[model samples]
Target chain A: MTQFIQQLINGLSIGSVYALIALGYTMVYGIIKLINFAHGDIFMFGAYVGMVAITTFKLNFFAALIVAMAVTALFGVIIERVAYKPLRKSSKTAALITAIGVSFLIQNGTQLIMGANIYAFPQIIANQYFDVYGVRINLLQLVIFFTSIILMFILQFIVKKTKLGRAMRSVAVDKDASVLMGVNVDNTITITFAIGSALAAAAGIMVGLYYIKIYPFMGFAPGLKAFVAAVFGGIGIIPGAMIGGFAIGLIETLVAGYGSTLYKDAVVYGILILILIVKPSGLLGKNVKEKV
Target chain B: MKNLLNKKNLVSLVLLVIIFFVFDYLIKARILTPYYRTVLYWMGIYIILSLGLNIIIGITGQLSLGHAGFMSIGAYSAAVVLASNPTITGLFIGMGVGIVLTMIVSFIVAMPTLRLKGDYLAIATLGVGEIIRIVILNMTITNGASGISNIKMLMSWPLLFGFVVLTIFLTNNFKQSAIGRACIAIKEDEIAAEAMGINTTKYKVMAFMFGAVLASVAGSLFATTYYVVKPETFGVNTSINILIIVVFGGMGSLSGSIISTIFIGFVNMALQPYAEMRLISYALVLIIVMIFRPQGLMGAKEVALNVLPDFKSFFRKKEKSS
Candidate 1:
């Protein structure tokens, strides 16, 4: 029972990060209908930025987190303006290909700058363990799990309450109608990228803190898994990402704990294929009838 | 008869034959070492793999990140057969079996996973590729992580060149067939093609099978060429490299795929001096080309046959045209 409880906490913590990354994937997909393949690299950038802040600025965890998010969000906006904006008027295929190109650019560029060695993150929040109901929990783990919940609620409030959020939502649903209603569609899209990138930065820091390792290629695996989670939860739905993240976390932990650790990736992917095949839109995704 | 005897295409064909002869003799004359010959062999293998992928990406309008999985199936199967049998004839039998088995596996795998679109297909295929990798990584007879080594070596310059010519011929013939037209139709618009009585699913499966089998065939050659087989060699990264070739060459263009394959193959081989930077450079090239030339070098255009010919023949053709 205690092992199960421990696994649950671990799952939730990692799942929170997946959820954060999934939000970035889902938001851009919802608005542009492009997968924005480079979004993972943005998450990677956030990790590097946070690592720099921690190493150079010698700041605490919270300060470094804020700085990383700001930098990533800024970079995301720049990417949107430079790479994506021009390709917007082109075919979706063009945009998709461009996104993949941007992803490769960032990943390869990072490899050039940082070299291939995995950088060790400074242990700002030390691995201090706490017991709950006879199950051990670490401080960083708790922080990840709770912070994500709080952030998710805050996001829900913003999307539901704020005017900018409503405008963004309107644009996602109907771009032409939103344009008619005086929403600066391009600006909204830029803001969406900024927000999503910021969220990804937060996830990046959490992962670095938990794992104590940061690499340029680290984003590929988690980002892919998060995308799967987004699809699993029902893409284009916010709550779905959160739910899917936690589900992925739990399943991953259980599989790794009970089964071979090497096969964990295979099992997770297998589950995703099963879910997609059986339930295409995901658990929360609505099936929008394609127009003939 | 005149259309069929177009002086331009005839000249192009002759030039190709001449180029092949030059290279063939160069290797045969010991001017090009066996190692360099091996590199050329990989170039041919990659061309086959990329062309097959192009049929799916450029023609059928599908994205797959798991092609390496099929290649692994071919490699392992061929390696096992060659190891157990130790006969040169077994190598050919192994390749045939590897290709057929890969086709069957891909067909089964595509049925369940084809529902996902866009990036989702990318993810699923990525997973499938990794799964195959891990499965191979854990298998006993495959030698797990150390990999299966000391397999029978059947690959040589002649065999490789023969296989390359055969693959190119088959792909070209298919490209000229009705099925190729159907694939193009599917790519242009799936729903519209379906409305026109084209079975999109069936065509997709057909195109995917063709690509997978070709990948497997390449895998067979790869196993024989390397004289060993390892799971790590054929993984997600290999799949990505193949994808980069097709995308860089211009999707749906056969000649483009061929040109890009050789270009990338030679560049990648030449860049071997800078081992770590090889992938990074390729990645940079992909980003730059995608932004500047999304349609790729030749776009969807084919190589113009008129560009090739002997000087006298060219003049004769021009005179004849006038």
Candidate 2:
């Protein structure tokens, strides 16, 4: 029972990070209908940026976090403007391939710069453990959980209350109609990318701190799993992404705890296939019929 | 029979024979470097894989990212079979087994996932591909991650050349067949094709299976050439590389696939000097290509022999002269 609680805490901590990344994926997909395969790499970029800021520039943890988010947000905007905007009228397949191209570019480019080696992330925060009901919980995990929750709530408030959020929602619903109503569709899209990337940046820093390790290609697995999470809860729905992230994190932790670690990835992919087969719309996604 | 002996067919056959003899002579004379030979061999394998993938992605408009999974299945199946019976007959038997197994696997993957359109299907196929890799990694027969090594190397320059020709001929024929036309109809518009009584599901599955068959054959050749079959060899990167060849050549154009496969093969060789920057450059090229010319080099058109002028245009010229 104690082990279960401990595992649960670990899952929630990791799940919160997945949620941050999934929000980016869900938002980009919601607006552009492109998977933005490089979103994971953006998370990796954030980690690297945070690492550099702390180690090279001697910035504090929160400052580095803000710096990473800002830098990644800018990168997100640049990628969209340069790689995606031109192919807007092309086939979706072309866009997908381009997104994949961007992903490989970031991953390999980073690898070239970083020499494909894992770097130990410095401990920015003091590691302190707290015990509750005979179950140990770490201060870092608490910080991650609360920070993610606060960020998510702030995102929710923005989406629900802000004008830019309204524009974003309108653009997602109907791009042409929104443009007709003077929504500045392009700016809204750029903003969406920026916001999503910033959130992913936060996740990256948190993950780096939690794991105490960062690498160029570290984003691939977690990014893919976060994508699974987004699909699981309901892709394109903000709250759905949150739910899916935590669910997948928990499922993954429990499976690894009980089953062979070798098959954990297989199990996660199996669940993805099963969910896609059973509920194509996902858990929170509404069933949208093909119109044509 | 008469059509088989047509001038174009004879000329193409003679061209292929001459090319093969030249290549064999060059290798025998040691004029061509071993590096070039290896590159050509890899190019041949990629040509088969990409052509097969084109049938699914370009002609049928079904995007699959799991092609390497099918290829790995073929590679491992062939490797295991050839381990005991190391003969030409064993090679054929291995390829046969690969084809059948790939057909079955592709059919199974296609059935449920084909219902989902576009990106969903892509993700599902990707999932299935990863699942196959993981399963292979864990299986005892697959040697569990260390992979099957030191298989008899049966692939030769002549054999690889022959298979490449056969793959091209078969894929070209399949493209012009009635079933191929149905597949194209579905690609143009699935609903319209369905309305016209075309069995969309059946044709999609058939195209996918045919592609799997070709990939499997290529996989058999790959295992024999390298004398090793590892799970890591068939990953998302392999699948993407094949897709890159297909797209770079021009979707729906067999000739384009051939051209682009050779072109990229040479480009890869050239980029070997800058090993670390190769993939970065490759990704940049993909992005640039998509942005500048999404239709690719051939733009969905086939390269054919321009044997005769149009009779209508000739008559119009005559009328003007008169």
Candidate 3:
């Protein structure tokens, strides 16, 4: 029973990170129908940026978090402007290749800048154990999970309430129509990239704290997993991404606990395949019908 | 007859023969090191993988993130056979058997799954790829993560070079023929191709088979060259890397794929000094190209003589304009 409670906590914490990344993925896919393959690498970049903030700027955990998000958001905008914008009129195949190229560039470029060794996040958040009815929990786990939830809510509020949010929604639904409706489509896209990247940065910081290790290619697994979560939740749906992330988290944690740890990834991917086979549009995604 | 000699086709044919002799002489005279020979082995294998990838991505206009699964099937099959038999004849027999088995497996997997469109196909293929890797990981015959090693080395430069030439020649010929035109028509629009009396399914299956065959050849070469097989080595990353080479070269452009493969391979081998940065360089190439030249280095266009005439046109611009 205690083990179950412990597993739940672990699952929620990791799920929060996956949710944050998935949100970025879902949001970007919603706005621009391109599967931004480089989004994961952007998350990796955020981790590296956060590390730089801690070691170079000597900032506290919160400050580094802000800085990491800001830096990653800026990089996201730059990537959008450079990689995606120019190829707007090209075929999806072209865009797809470009996305791959961007993914490779960011990953390998980071590897060049930072050595292969995993960089440890500063222990500024402080590690403390809190007991809960005979079950002990780490303070950082709660911090990560709650912080992710809070950020998610804030994003929800922005997308659901704010004018810019409405504009973003409009742009995602129909770019041509949004353009006719006086929405700054390009700027909205840039903002989408910014917000998505910022979330990725936050996830990276939290992951760094939990694992105490950061590497150039670290984002590959988590990134791919987050993508699965996004797809599982029905890509382009925000709430779907959150639900999918948490579900993946719970499933992955349970698998690790019950099954061989090596099979965790296989199990997660297998679940995604099964889900996709059953519901092509995902759990929350609506099946869009074409006019033609 | 005189006009035929002046045709670009005849010129290319002659040039190909010359290049082949030069390559053959270099390997025969031992001018090229064994290291170069080994690199060529991977180069040939990569070409096979990339070409197979191109069939799905280029001709069928479907996205797959799991072509490496096909390679894994071939590699493991070949490795298992060679490991069981010590004779040289077994090696040839194993490769032939491996190639055939891989194609059959690919046919089964691709038949039902290729029905899924676009991103769905991508996801399914990815799943299929991961499944293959996991299966390999668990299989006792493959020896799990320790993999299969100390297999007989049955191939060298001369044979590998011949294989590469044959593959290129066959693929190029296919691309120029009516069947290749059918592939292009399919890429342009599947519905339209079907209306034009083309059997979209048949052509798609053919393209898939072609890709699978190349992957099988690559697998055989890898089994012979590396003499080891690991599940992790043939994962989604391998698929993505091959995709990168094909995309970087240009979709539907055989020459482009060959050139890009060599360039990327050269950079990977030569940039060992940079270690981790080599990966960074590759990533940068992917990102930059996607951003700037998403159509790849050639944009579905061949290199070689195809581009030379364009340069010639530039010089003869005034005459043609007049």
Top TM-score: which candidate number?
A: 2
Sort candidate 2 into its docking category.
Answer: medium
Which parts of model 1 are misplaced by more than 4 Å? B1-17, B275-278, B304-322
Which clashing pairs does model 1 show? none
Residue-level lDDT for B93 in candidate 2: 93
DockQ for each numbered candidate:
0.48, 0.73, 0.43
Candidate 3 lDDT tens digits, B54-161: 767865677778788888877887888888785656766766886897778767767766656566667677777887788789889889998899878887656676
lDDT of 2: 0.88
Order candidates by DockQ, high to low.
2, 1, 3
Could you give the CAPRI-style class of model 3? acceptable
Tens digits of lDDT, candidate 2, A1-292 = 9999988988898999999999999999999898888999999999999999999999998899889999999999999999999988888888988998999899999999887999998888888999899889999999899989999999999999999999999999999999999999999999999999999999999999999889988887888889999999888999989999998888888888888889888888888888888997789889987897
True interface contacts reproduced, per candidate = 0.49, 0.69, 0.64
lDDT of 1 at B259: 84
TM-score of each: 0.92, 0.95, 0.88
Q: Of the candidates shown, which would achieve the greatest DockQ relative to the real structure?
A: 2
**In candidate 1, how many Å is residue A6 off?**
1.7
Between candidates 1 and 3, the one scoring higher on TM-score is: 1
